[model samples]
Target: MIVLLGITLAVVILVVVTWMLLTRRLREKYAALWLVIALAVLVLGIFPQLLETLTGIFGVQVPANLLFSMAIVLLLGVSLHLSWELSQAEDEIRRAAEEVAILRAQVERIERAISSGKASGVEDADGVG
Candidate 1:
């Protein structure tokens, strides 16, 4: 039983590593998860008894694969939500920048008008003297 488990785990790891390499999906962001999956598989491969003991300690009755799948799904959903928020923020920033430009133009025009008006105003020549 242990030998069979080891062989199965070895095959799974090889397949996963090959897939990641081929797809170029070995980014640092997902590195931890990959490492965890790798380590878990390795441990399970080399020591099925140990894995059983650990599972018993943790009171985890569900299959490891099912738990891993759920985690991946949750991570994907959170990532998508974050991406959506970032996109919304980007749009808001663009609009704010446009508004700032408009206000800056208005201010410049106002300053120019004020300066011209001041220049054109002649204090009564006597008063100026």
Candidate 2:
């Protein structure tokens, strides 16, 4: 088991390093998060007892697969939250675009009125005595 952990840790380190190099992103940007995940997988893959210990914290007596399934559900919850925020932003953008279009049309109408009055040599009633 110890050997397996060492191997897994080495593999994870190598893969993370390779990814960071390929992406050209500062490792610090993602290093901490990936390190935690790699360490978790390495620990869990090699020491099943760790899962039992973790489950005990939540009063859970389920298999590791169930815990994995719960993680998937949590990811879906995050995705749903992001989707809701995007939907709200989209609605706000649409409303803003409509308002801008209306304002542009009003400005165009005013401009046309001014040009036509100039051509006809008529005083703007609102502006004259």
TM-score of each: 0.48, 0.52
Go through the candidates in order and give each one's C-alpha lDDT.
0.71, 0.73
Measured on C-alpha atoms, candidate 1 has an lDDT of: 0.71
How many backbone clashes does every candidate have?
0, 0
Of the candidates shown, which would achieve the greatest TM-score relative to the real structure? 2
* Tens digits of lDDT, candidate 1, 8-113: 8767876786688668876545544565666666766777677567666767785575546656986797689669978999999999999999999999998997
Which one wins on lDDT? 2
Error of 1 at 67 (Å): 0.4
Model 1 reaches what TM-score against the true structure?
Answer: 0.48
